[model samples]
Target: MKNTEQFIGKRVLVVGLAKSGMAAAGLLHRLGAEVIVNDARPLEGNEEAATLQALGIEVIGGGHPSDLLERGFDIIVKNPGIPYSNSLITQALERGLRIWTEVELAGLISEASIIAITGSNGKTTTTTLLYHMLNIGKKKPLIAGNIGTVACTVAEKAKNDEVMVLEASSFQLAGTENFKPHIAIFTNLYDAHLDYHGSTTEYLDAKLQVARNQTAEDFLIYNNDQEIVRSSVETMHAQKIPFSTEGKVVEGISADEEWIYWLGEPFISTKEIKLPGRHNLENILAATAAAILTGCKKTAIENVLSSFTGVRHRMQFVREFNGRTIYNDSKATNTLATKSAISSFKQPVILIAGGLERGHSFEELRPHMNNIRTVVAIGETAERFTEFAKSCGVEQSLLATTMEDAVKVAYESSSEDDVILLSPSCASWDQYPSFEIRGDQFIHAVMKL
Candidate 1:
């Protein structure tokens, strides 16, 4: 880590005790900051709170004390999941106090160059793929951010020779002030997280923060096919590098039906890529462009793209059982994602979907249901999704109470050479703690068959 004196002797208040929060508080305490952590959860049996307390950091738990801000903190390091609408956050804004997510801290302390990837849907896939490409190319790369690891924790131990590839979310980006990446990749933007961001414009603005602080010496690999993303980068200070899977581009990366081209020169053939779906192709193009900027060779990029099937729970191919191909896309928490997954396959699909009822129409999926032979719905949105499926002219629509049952129904409904997929077009919180747990249950059930 860089020997930065910015946090020295500063009074820092860390909001929320999530993984990122704990890491940030610890880092701040070590950086000579007088740190205090406040979490809504009760103090008793709170191991995280206890651990921080042991490190000489004050922990206030159970609830946000009404006058907590009166304690006078220099800056507030907030957990990204905590919305700006939170009372404490709102008051901080009213008080004119600076606020940030841990990504800013990571950027502040890390000696390594950062490669940040952000998008509505493909952040995880692109981050993971780029990390692999860099690793294969013998560039030491550490993976962090929304993919799982806390960015601050990884940045703490990162060496100057290493590259930090972060999967940034809109929530995280919204709180970042000086969090700039050496190379930034904006995969593609779509309508998502409107509830947290309050509007599509706000959400896009937050995602654009990935490159907001970059200078001309930096690089921004963006999706040229997305007009919003394309146009948004026009004012950015970074050297712009465009990637498009749609057609040829004047410069940077482009893909046609046959091959991927960099600077209009052929780089790799599309036939060599093992991962399915056009959405994934977009991810591959973005990752490849970033990898090239990082000096990764074509061999490194090809080795990963030619063999990497998919990220776990993101249209991941599970196994072929009883002449049926199974895929676990439990990460498809919205209709746009499900639509991409459904369009990835040409075989007849027995789809298991449905989750939290966000009160949004599934009508966006109607045009992509031609290959959907059967629909097994579950969770709070089950009934509504089943009805929507029937309306889409899918011959068989059934409701299942459990993941196992859904898998059973889908498998039974499938024919030889058919695809059985779990692509819930809603959040997993209706039945599972997270999409990962929902995906694990689906995978376990599939393995049992």
Candidate 2:
């Protein structure tokens, strides 16, 4: 963004008290924007609440005011959860007030060079891997956005020379107009966030925005293995750099056999990469392509890929339960991801699946009959998953009341050759605040058994 233009003195409305909301509010106020912040729920006098009040901003505890439409503001910086078609926000737009996501707003003020990764799956993994590479590459990178920290918070105190690796969600990208990244990655897209996006087309359109505003001088690193991402990217105006397992692109990247190829040059081999599944190898290729785009040496990419530890809650190896290998892959919040996780394992598995349903039905999960021994369903969509598993001809399918119970039952139902896996193909909102907490609890439950 051009530094000559700043929103410091402008009137802005920050919707929601999520991490992005609070960060935007505080930073906007600091930068001279007259901020009015509101959250759907009242703050419980937490540190987050205190931070907002310290910024001298007025807070509407719960709900956006009806007057928000009548009272004019320069811009409405919305949280990702609030649909873009919100009546109040729509009315504000009609009245001539502009709207922006905190993600977009933060991108404008960041001093660090942005390296962003977006996809339905593997975003967090790619983001974490890029951060790990840049973090130890010179100790000059901050991992943020949908995966690590709020981008605004990281930008507020970021060093000018440091690189920022962010995992951008389609929800965050949907309403953005001018958020630019130096090196952008579109990891393999799948059917996800359907509940909010309304359709698969809308969701893919949202993800495409990562490259939509980028110029020819900027770099777009995307997945070649995903047909939709590959096809849709042709319309984008950015200089395209494709990465995939299928084939290498001219002046882009690819994964051939055990090696990670970047710009037609093999930087790292998958045999030495620590991350488990082929899905993660795809993520590494995307990250390596971005890193190589940023002028990091092939050896640097190879060095980091070998040392990078996988993201938490994403197929995290937890513990063994009475000879049963247990994994906490609670971050597999969609059927495609859960399918990838389960397909990676060689053993017949005891799978723990379900949570807050997010419009995901069971078609993608049915083909893994040979690897799955039983599926222990739980949470809101338990019955739906159980029915689907039964239809797939799985002999053992049961529902447990909670993650603790699910772990217990999985331990009981497994043998020495079986893998007890907690790879829930749904959100963790039913029992935990986030996937990390759900994963931690899963590990705790496994240790008990």
Candidate 3:
């Protein structure tokens, strides 16, 4: 594989005008390339369009052009938000144009090795933990991907032998070609992103595509606890290393006797990790596999793992008022992750559940409602979830008209020592742009009380 500087002075078609797209367009324009950026929005009132205009980049509303595929591109920089099956992108590929995602573009210019993590859950926690460990090492590791900076932005700062840790989402990986990592990690996968993928198999396939382009020389660290991830990752080209709650590994990691174990030179058991929940223990396993593979000492991982406060919104302890502790777990956008969040609690929980439903059946989580004291549902999925809660014999459930009202009801309903958790098993698209916004709103509501 050779590095082609073909993009220099070449006419580049930048598709998608989000942050990544604007960044790509700006970068290309600065590099002496003719940059044309496109997006589906019909007008320029949003931040994306404003950024494009500010950059003096010609922006087009609505999808790709028909002439793009026929003429082909010197290079196509795609935003990770777009799907791989997009017709215009596919058509451009058929014409032999080099199509690279923001992540792929970032990897090309990154002078450092990459540590990429992907999963339906815990990616943010694991990514943040890895960064914390690097900080404890006193090294600067660029933490980017789905959570922070897009890959293309990082690629421009490539320095030799530097380590770039990325949180690659399935959306990012779907369009990534030649996006190799020195070490790639797969956390557990569950039913998620089905709206974009249309089915579980397709969603899993899109995720495993991270390893699909890798060679045996590369290293893959994954969770053995995930049957779907283990089965979907058929890439034997890379070294298959599993981190598990059970099973032994020649070069894998697992927990036994309440200690994290590894198979490497400084093979030692982690004694006291500070991250919350057993789900985080699984996250620690995935992180340890990546750390060990990258030659990070077991002692170092343990040291940071003890001090890690955990990622925000994944079982985040919001506040303690009137003997009831509130936790904002707005990031639990799927039923399985919500199930894990609920399981993390011992005291009876007053769960504030509901939001934009992704068409997931609540049957799996229904069986575990015995621990729920009273479920105060709100948002779009309130009716659907409240119905499910009742069907599961949830005696005390109410569908609130708004999030603030829901929070009020939940706090009023719970006794001292009971946990009030905002663990919506669906996205927040109905009322908010992101889970962070929804979580912040919940926090504001609670504070006002």
Provide TM-scores for the models: 0.96, 0.88, 0.88
- How many pairs in model 3 have backbone atoms within 3 A of each other, for residues 3 or more apart or on separate chains, i.e. clashes? 2
Candidate 3 lDDT by residue in tens digits, 293-322: 666765677787777765777777777899
Per-model tally of clashing residue pairs: 0, 4, 2
- Model 1 misplaced stretches (Cα beyond 4 Å): none
Task: State the TM-score for model 1.
Answer: 0.96
Full candidate order by lDDT, most accurate first: 1, 2, 3
In angstroms, give how far residue 25 of model 3 lies from its true place: 2.0
| Candidate 3 lDDT trough over 10 residues, lowest sum | 264-273
- Tens-place lDDT digits, model 2, residues 1-449: 23525876788888877788888888888788888887777667556666788768888775666776555678888888888677777777678767778778767888888888888788888887777666556748888888778887887777778888888898888858889988889987777678788999999999988888788888888887778888999987788888777766657777767666666766666788766677887888787777766667666766776766567788776765567777779888887779899987887889999999767677988887567889899988999998988888887999999788998888888889788888888998987899889889888888887
Where model 3 places Cα greater than 4 Å from the true spot, the runs are: 1-4, 42-58, 84-87, 198-201, 213-217, 247-250, 264-271, 297-299, 357-360
TM-score winner, 1 or 2: 1
lDDT, candidates in the order shown: 0.93, 0.80, 0.78
Residue-by-residue lDDT tens digits, candidate 1, 316-335: 98998979989999999988
Model 2, stretches more than 4 Å misplaced?
A: 1-5, 41-54, 307-309, 319-324, 355-360, 379-387, 398-405, 412-417, 428-434
